[model samples]
Target: LGIGGVRLLRALGLNPQVFHMNEGHSAFLGLERVRELVAEGYAFPVALELARAGALFTTHTPVPAGHDAFPLDLVERYLGGFWEKMGTDREGFLALGLEEKPWGKVFSMSNLALRTSAQAGGVSRLHGEVSREMFHHLWPELLREEVPIGHITNGVHTWTFLHPRLRRHYAEVFGPDWLRHPEDPATWRVEGLGEEFWRIHRDLRAELVREVRSRLYEQRRRNGESPSRLRQAERVLDPEALTIGFARRFATYKRAVLLFKDPERLLRILQGPYPVQFVFAGKAHPKDEPGKAYLQELVAKIKEFGLEDRMVVLEDYDMYLARVLVHGSDVWLNTPRRPMEASGTSGMKAALNGVLNLSVLDGWWAEAYNGKNGFAIGDERVYENEEAQDVADAQALYDVLEGEVLPLFYAKGPEGYSSGWLSMVHESLRTVGPRFSAARMVREYLALYQKGQEWAGKARGEQEVLRAFHQALPAFYGLALRVEVPGDLTLNGEPLRARAYLEGEVPKVLRPFLEVQLVVCRA
Candidate 1:
């Protein structure tokens, strides 16, 4: 499909200067480009070099299974003739997707994409570091921190996701320029909200409650529930309750059932005088029966614990439901295991609508959390085991809910208003609204595209250099180099030295092939 996509674009007379492959799924585009270059009278190796210069790839998955791979026989069956047309033999083409292990029959799409792209990146800062370690095999001579991948944190489309009510309010306060400058904190103008803001906020909550009740009643009716039970949906959730929303793709690493780890403790918190309510919605993959079973268990616990009115998971989650939850909920919850989430963007949508985030510091939360703008789940600690991590995170959730979240939320001042909670809401809106919008993301991409185009143009202009480098590829294949750091290494505002031991068909003046990085760590 990826190869066909490139062909289709060419048929339409589209000459893309930079090929941005969002993931390995479309990595075949790189191969197609090389084939095109070969047809234009370039040698196979030189074609690969030029094609790589014009390619950029972004990796979004940290887990191994998230990557796509295929059997060698399958690749040959599909692409054998295609490679043959480019004057490349079977083994040479197969080597493009080679795995490092002894059992190397499978071809990794990610490996092929990494080798072919001139630039690569992860979706967030932490994910960039994680990606470097994950793909360091491609650059064995470089230090871990010196791996080439960078990051551009994910963002949300503010106008598409922001509530209409909030949009109107923002426009009134900051003028129509707010729409164009949604990433600017000054454009939000939280101070201008005044008393009318809370009134409208209450109305938004009431509207969300009505929307959920209507959807739930219809779902139950279709499922053959009693009419009496269906009617009870009208009183499902309180509009004024401290609502915490947890919604995303139903993956186990997200730990959707983390709060239910201790039912008794969760019950205690929910049964308080100023009780809290939760809104949960997500869909498991079609083949993910275990995820579906977890969802069923969660719903059963809600009923068995007699907390139906305080919690509900809407059916067939969609964009409309996401808008309702982000706009109406008082708090947005995300609990992905550390370093597993690439760049979760739902919480950014929630924060844009003045919803406070209570999330584990992973993905974008690692960069966004400021101790006051949002609540943290746990300290940045990597536990030795999954069970230990779950226990610690659950306890931290309970502690924050009881000690900080609930207290501030239910602390009514004048006319039943929690000024402290409102202050946090304002801060979240002010800080995150501008920083995590699609406008900023597009600008960053444009800057990177300019850089990529310049690099590709240089490579295209210097064909002789590319031909020379291609000729050197075989000698560089199995070369090994060792480095030794000085014994008295220190960073007390002084220089450090290291010696390299290169042993192979070596190239003199090896400055182009060698790089040095000094790593500093606390004792």
Candidate 2:
């Protein structure tokens, strides 16, 4: 489908100077481009080189199973015709995507993309590092750090996600400049919004509550629940209460059940003086029975404990429902397992709407969470076991909510506003709003394309020099460095130096193109 789309565009005279693959699914486009080049009398190597120079691939998966791979026979059945057209035999064509397994042959789309693209990347900083290690076999000629993959943190389309009421308020207060200059964080004003901000938010919450009541009533009627139970739907949540929302695709790694880990603790928090309500919505993949079961368990627990008045899991999650949750909820909750989430953007949407995020320090939050801007779930600790990690993180979630979030949210004054909490909301919007906008993401992608084009231009007509340099790249990649460091250092206090040793040798032919870098992580 991706190749067909690209070919169709080309047929209409749309020549893309830089082709970007968001994930492995679109990798076949690179092969299609190669076939086009080969038709123009270019050798396979030259075709591959030219096609790669104009290609960029971004991989979002952090786990092996998440990638797409097909067996050789399957690929032969589907894409066999592509080989002859590209002037390659089956063996030569298969080499582009073949996995080096000791077992049966499989052609990995990710491998194909990595081999055919000038650059590749993951969605976030940590994911980029993970991707380099995962795809190292594809680039044995380069160290993980030297792998062409880089990162541009994912972002949300702010204008699309911001609630209409908030949008109007922003325009009224800051005028039209903020929309055009969204990259300028200072342009978004939180001052003078004051009571008007809370009023708009209160109205959004009321709207969300009404929508939830209508949906719940309809769902009960469709499921044939008792008339009395169906009638109870309208009384589900209070618009004035402290509301937290959790909604996303129910992938197991997202840990939606983390909040329900300690049922009694959660109940106590909900039943406290500063009582809170939760709005939950998500859908599991049809084949993901465990994910479906986990979601059902939480919903069942909510009903079994008579907490339905304080919590409700909406059915059939969609964009409309997502807007209500993000715009209406007081806090947007995300608790994905550490290092597994690849740049979750729902929290960014929520932040732009002036809803504060309370998430695990993972994905975009790893970079966006300033201590003063948004709340983090736990310390950055890597546990040996998932069970231990879950327990520790669950406890941390409860602690933060009880000790900080709820207290501040309920600390209302004569003006009927939680000034302290509102201040944090202002800071969150001012800080993360601009940083995680789609405008910024588009700029980063264009910059990457420009950089790739420049490098491709540099290599043209220098093929003889490049060929020798490329031949010696494997030996250069095999080189290793060792460093010794002190066990501990003070925060912003010490200038530290480490002893280093270099190992391995590169071929003399590529000395001019080789350089080594030693970096210290200031973060």
Candidate 3:
């Protein structure tokens, strides 16, 4: 369908260039290209093989459940004629997991991805490793060591996350040179400037918080939300209070319950003289009714626990609110199970604005965290049993807050505001902030794209540039699968004939694989 859609879009005269296949949903673009070539009278073999170099495929799914697939009947109905045209006998198509998929009933999107693309990758280093092993069945030519799946860890856009004025303040103080040489000698020099600089950073954070709070309140009023609660939220807004923001899709894996793990501890922090507060927001997919209910339950907890003054679960979150939460929060809290998260751009947003992370040892945090900068929810929960992990993680979060976070926020140096908070802010920037921005990510991509293009060639580049793609393979191998019949030769127990791709002529030894096309199948 996507292949058809891409073809339609091109026919509409939009001159679109470069199709980024977010996932397998757009794999049909490859099919579309093949269709285009065929329409122009080029053979299927030339089109499919030639189109490989230009396209780039990035796989977001590390798990089998993540890929899309369709039943054999369904495939035949849509592209069955196309497959027949390409000479894909049952065994050859099945060899590529186009049939009899144990992962799913239908051909997997990941399977299609590995087989179809010249260049393919996972979203992060760990994911890349997982993906390589997962697809080892297909690339028997390459050992696990030789597999070609690459990695491009996700990153947040720095300019999008950091406050423009605060960023400019840093820019002004350090000069535009700071962007190029974030780790430069002069950049580190700014750390030594005592109290005055810390005051400026904190003041900027406070003002940004005000802007976000006003925006949220106004939006709520426009939506006809309770005016009294909106006013109450306004009154509760304290630029000076230790604010924590927890916002993301309400997946059960994110462990949203970590906040209530130790009811007494959390209540103490909220009830304390300084008054810590958390602003929560996120959406569950419309189909994930359970996850949506979990979010609603969290809202009920706010009322049940009388956390109305301290906790607010804003409903119907979107990109606009995301900006406010990441920019305004003193700390960004994320507690998903280990490795489930591929990469979290939200934490990166929080990092650039000097918001510390209180997160699990997963996602981008796995690479960026140091114990000194902020807190990781657990030490070995990343490697623990489910029950043990939950208990340990719950405790780990409490320890960081009660033992570390509270003291640092409220601590006053003998010399005052310059001492404690200033130290944490400076350390977080040096350790977490600079290392995770998009500028660093883009440089990694440029290198990857260049190398892939060289191997893929000019035709590959054109597809990537133009978003046009191949519809089918030109001379790809196809294998025949059949069951045995006693005293009779059978192809998968059906009347047997097979086809295989060979360099020149079909051979008997490879009859298990046939180069001859199956012109028909008997019932």
Collision count for each candidate, in order? 1, 0, 22
Candidate 3 lDDT for residue 240: 73
- The parts of candidate 2 lying over 4 Å away from their true place are 87-89, 101-103, 456-511, 514-523
Candidate 2 lDDT, 192-262, residue by residue in tens: 57889988888888888999999999988999999898989978899899889999999788888798889
Which model scores highest in lDDT? 2
Q: Per-candidate RMSD vs. true structure?
A: 2.8, 4.9, 10.2
Predictions in order: lDDT: 0.84, 0.85, 0.67
- lDDT string for model 3 (64-157, tens) is 6667877766766766656444444554443343634545657666666566567777767767777788777677866685587877878666
Model 1 Cα shift for residue 43 (angstroms): 1.7
User: If candidate 1 were superposed on the true structure by all CA atoms, what would the RMSD be?
Assistant: 2.8
Per-prediction TM-score to the true structure, in the order listed = 0.93, 0.89, 0.76
**Residue 455 deviation, candidate 3, in Å?**
1.2
Query: lDDT value for candidate 3?
Result: 0.67
Give the range of the ten consecutive residues with the poorest summed lDDT in model 2.
458-467
Query: How much does candidate 2 score in TM-score?
Result: 0.89
Q: Write the per-residue lDDT of candidate 1 for residues 407-522, one digit (tens) a residue.
A: 99889888666888888888888888888888888888788888889888988898877777767766765687688877855768877677877677654334376654556567
Candidate 2 local accuracy as lDDT?
0.85
